[model samples]
Target: MREPVRLEISVAGHAGHVFASREGDGGSVPASGPAVVLIHGIGVSHRYLRRLHRLLAGSVDTYSIDLPGFGATPRPANTLSIAAHARYILSAMEQLGVPEFVLVGHSMGTQFATEAALQAPPGRISNLVLMGPVVDPKRGTVAQQALALGRDCLLHESPSSNALVFTDYLRCGPVWYLKNLRLMMEYPMEQKITGVRAPVLVVRGANDPVADADWSRRLAGLAGRGQLQQVQGTGHVVQHNRALEVRDGILAFAGLGAAAGGEPLPGNPT
Candidate 1:
């Protein structure tokens, strides 16, 4: 049901693709309101995000991306850091002519989202959504994180979800995966998020082993303006299986519902 990204964009030589609202894409370019941009975790691409992107795009302009070195995008000559990746994302969105947008990230993508929100110019990023955030400080080592991911795949994720993930992993290959694994393990998500000015929404599946409940709550409490939501009967890929739930949380956080299009929730200050 997902279509190929019709455009390829680059920033500082790092190229990536974006699937967004455009003519012939079933949705027109968003004229107003904050756009939604989805970022995927390592070893995966926009394929897994397609469902959520579709759900969000129906109400507001939305985008799902394939970052450089993953999916169809060509790999970079060298591995880039979290900040460099964030820079690529922001620069590419600017090229898309997006003035302000909401950033939604899953798993390791949370790291990139946090950095992007922090790095964006004041008022550019309206909200930050981190679903199934990763690298719990107490269990931050590769072995522990791998164990949690394996447990999640075996116990929580569905067969179709497993298929999408493993296929993306195969495309990512072990070399590029291992090259960035260190950064994912070392990046302090909790610490980095503390500096983000945008309101943060931390979401995790109640059953997700990768992102412990306590950790998600902690990250929310650390942010200047943050909140946590857990979707029941789901896991690490919460947004995929519980797309509607994710959509509700995002729309509520953005104050889109209960108040017609592009307005703050009644009585709640934006």
Candidate 2:
């Protein structure tokens, strides 16, 4: 039998209340261990990470928050940039009394996570795990850039149209969603990814349509503690179809698997 998940809602800054949840309300966190801060990619909400969270429950104290404009939370009054997103999550963590954590970012969230880890107080971010991370905008092919631009324009310029196109994101509404989209586009990720100090696990689906193998390799090379892993037969949403693979990699990297407390990461665990 599975434990019934519990909800813990808290208002964050002027952004609105974040509906965070977990299984146990007890004193002890969990066996998987350290508090984890999960960040989702563009267009999706915390719902996208549901499977990854469940798979990791036994080993980590997991927390997933809807980015300012995404999920169920309202957007903030100020512009939402990579820095702003990072700051907000940090503040949320501070309020929760979570001193340190492992960051798990998917797609666009990976870009924000990189910026966040760079700014995190020393010792605050223990590790970073990026799934389908974004490539340098300039490095993206013309077609890729065009797609990214089209997506951004839709989210920022046409709220009604965007809502219709990305009904999932629109659930959060346009005002904040548009603002958040603008901020994500303006972030200078290329320069920042290199400054991150935490160990980074750059993961991707073998068949990911967006962040392809080449893109993942390049981003991995640019991160703080970068390494690459390709989940076979999976697409951009590797966490969705290959939850076990993703969780296993994270456990090994975070040193949660049986072995030395913090052993070096081994190649493909399959």
Residue 65, candidate 1: alpha-carbon lDDT: 79
Go through the candidates in order and give the clash count of each.
Answer: 0, 6
lDDT per residue (tens digit) for residues 185-237 in model 1: 88988778778888888888899999988888887878888788888898999
Find the candidate with the highest TM-score and give its number. 1
lDDT tens readout by residue for model 2, 161-233 = 2333356665756665565555555566666667877787888877765676766777667664677878777
The lDDT, on a scale of 0 to 1, for candidate 2 is 0.66
Pairs clashing within candidate 1:
none
Give the runs in model 1 whose Cα sits over 4 Å from its true position: 1-5, 22-28, 258-270
Shift in Å, residue 220, candidate 2: 1.1
